[model samples]
Target: MFHVAALGELLIDFTPVGLSNAKNPIFEQNPGGAPANVLALVSKLGKKTAFLGMVGQDQFGLFLKEVLEKNNINVSGLKISEKFQTTLAFVHLDKSGDRTFSFYRNLGADMMLNASDVNYEVIKEAKIFHFGSVSMTEEPVRAASIKAAMFATENGSIISFDPNYRPLLWSSVEEAKKIIGIGVKLADILKVSEEELELITGKIDVAVGADMLFREGVKVVLVTLGKRGCYYKYTGGEGYVDGYAVNAIDTTGAGDAFLGAFLYQICDMKMDELCGLNKNDFKRIIDFSNAAGALATTRTGAIPALPSIDEIHNIRLTR
Candidate 1:
């Protein structure tokens, strides 16, 4: 059985390279899409993962499928659509390694994934069902994603969600919040950026925002704090862990890496063991994940930046 089954977009991220002699900027194509990136890290850590999403029948789509297979994730659940071309995002990274995107997706193939295209068998077979908010921005894909999540839950799979919010993807903040809130309610475990927490809850304090999620039936809420590490909260417990020191080159998939590492620990444990975890047990997981996130930022690209399990352990050993 697959350890995780993820359903979402598979798009290209065009990152800035440099300006030419003529003063025109160049870009390098990198494969990215939040759910794909997360599963890449999980698969990198030796977990069996499968991807479920539609991609255009184009060269870029073919390349993304190859990249996922190369990353050790199963591609059997991937679908190809003839109606829309592959989606593209022009990524701009500021001095702090923060990124913004300009998406070219007027009817992207990812947005065309209908409920009929969903892999119900894959969701039923997986131990964890993962998804992101990006696919919820449109129809058909939104219906497919929600259907998969429901099937996974019915089959006893843990639902994992990441609100990897890119403001540019949505038409309005209020609508975005409403849709993303639907994802929050469906998840057992959630990963959100500090900004995403505020966006979803309209609260500045992490604890208060996390509490809002807890009331939504979310069991564990993890708030990513970038370089400061992460803040985590669960029933009767909560704490912050500092990330390891690293000269980050890019922060693209760092959060994904952190989340994957944390979920890896969950996949390793029995449901009973997970239920028995206390505050101290959570601290160990957070520390390990923080190191993994730090290591990912020290490199470039999402899949390429993912560190090995041994590498993450070594970081903890050396520290």
Candidate 2:
């Protein structure tokens, strides 16, 4: 059985190759999508992982499948749709390596997935079921993802949610908030960035944001603070894991890497160990995740930038 199973989009990221030449900038193709990136990170860390989603029967879809297969993630849940085209995103990185996205996904293949498309057996077998908010922007796929999350919870699987909010994807901010709030209530572990927290709670403080999520029924709340590190709060405990010092080249996939590593670590531990973990244990997990995120920044692309367990250990040792 796989340790984690993720359901959502799988697509191509076209990143600008040269900063100086805007008019004639080269574009490099990379496999991405929050769920796909998480699967890649977990697989790279030597965890058994599977991905469930739909891709178009196009060259881009084939490319995404090949990437996941090469990374050792189970591709059985991936389906190719004939009616819709593959999704594509154009990513532009600023001087600080933070990215701005221009997406072309007008009813893309991924959004076409319905509840009928989900493989219940795969969800039942996994220890953790992870997903993101982008998949909830549309109809049938949104309903399918929510149903999957509910099923996973009922079947004794821990649910992980990352509300990777994109304003342009939803009909309105109010709608996005309502949908993401439902996810927050359903998730056992919820990850959010500073911007996402502000968007959801209209609060800038991590403590306040974490408190709001806890009240929403999330057992664990992770607030990622770019280079400063991550803040975590659970039932009756809360604290921060200081960030690792590194020269980051790109910030893409840092959050995905962090979430994947944290979940993988929890899965690797025994159920008793996981349940018995105290504040120190939580800190250790966050520290490892922070290292994974920081190391990811030193490299360029998203999936390719994720550090292996050895690399994470070495980086931690040296730091």
Candidate 3:
């Protein structure tokens, strides 16, 4: 069975590299999109993964397909759109490597995916099915994402969700909350940044926010606290795992790295085994994930920045 199968956008991220001779920023094209970033890290850890989404029949789209194939992820369900171009996000980073985005997707190819285009076979065969809110920002793809999640759940696949919310993609905060809430309800494992936890639960306290998710029927809640660490609440227990210290150059895909590493460790476990994990068990797992996220930030791009298993271990040893 596939370790993980994800349904979402597969797009390009134009991350600034350096300043041009004219003092303008020079950007580099990086393979991105949250779900794809997660799969890349999982594949790095020797997991079998698949990507299901739409990309334009263009240069960037073709390049993304090649990147996934090279990373050893199954791309058989990745569709090429003739009507729209691939989505693009220009990432602007501050001194601390925190990022903001400017998107070029009014009607991007990823948002064109219809429910009929979903690969039920991929979802059915996956041990864990992952998705994010970016794909839920618009039509067709929104329906496609929901359909895949429901199908995966019905087929006994563990559903993982990350509300990698990008404000530019949403028409209104209320709309985002509504759809993202649906994702939260479907997830057996839900990963969110601290800010996202507040966005979804309307509570500032991490524990309280997690409590709200638990009440919503979510089995696991992972709240990522950049630089500080991660807080997790499972069915039987909860705890916080401190983050590793690293010279972060870009925090673009750090969260994806964290979730991917976390998933990689638990992908093979049964539902009962997952639910039975206590605080100590989660601390060991989240610490490893924290190292992966920290290591990803030491570099610039998303997929290109994912650390090898050795690198992750070395980072953990520093603690």
* Candidate 1 lDDT by residue in tens digits, 1-319: 9998899999998877789899998888899898898899889888899999988899999999999989989988899887789999887778877777899999999999999988788887799889998999989898888888988889989899998887878889998899998899899999999899999999999989998888878988999998898998887588798889888878888888898888887986655466568888888999999989989888767777889988999999976
Candidate 2 structure quality by residue, lDDT tens digits, 1-319: 9899999988888977774545687889988899989888988988899999999999999999999999999999998999998899888888888988888999899999999999989998899999999999998899999999999989988889999998889999999999998888888888999999988888998899889888877788899999999999885489888999898778888999999889988986644466468888778889999999998888878998899898899888975
**Residue pairs in steric clash, candidate 1?**
none
Taking every candidate in turn, the Cα RMSD to the unseen true structure, in Å, is 1.3, 1.6, 0.8
Go through the candidates in order and give each one's C-alpha lDDT.
0.88, 0.89, 0.93
Query: Against the hidden reference, what TM-scores do the models get?
Result: 0.96, 0.96, 0.99
Pairs with backbone N, CA or C atoms under 3 Å apart (clashes), candidate 2: none
Question: Which of candidates 1 and 2 is the stronger one according to lDDT?
Answer: 2
Model 2 TM-score, all chains together: 0.96
Question: Weakest 10 consecutive residues, lDDT, candidate 2?
Answer: 268-277
lDDT of 3 at 196: 91
Report the C-alpha lDDT of model 3 over 1-319, residue by residue, as the tens digit. 7999999999999999999999999999999999999999999999999999999999999999999999999998899988899999999999999999999998999999999998888888999999999999999899899999999999999999999989889999999999999999999999998889989999999999998898888998999999999998987788788998889999999999999999999988987798898768878999999999999999999999999999999877777
Runs of candidate 1 with Cα error greater than 4 angstroms are 270-272
lDDT of 1 at 258: 91
Evaluate model 3: give its TM-score.
0.99
| Candidates arranged by lDDT, highest first | 3, 2, 1
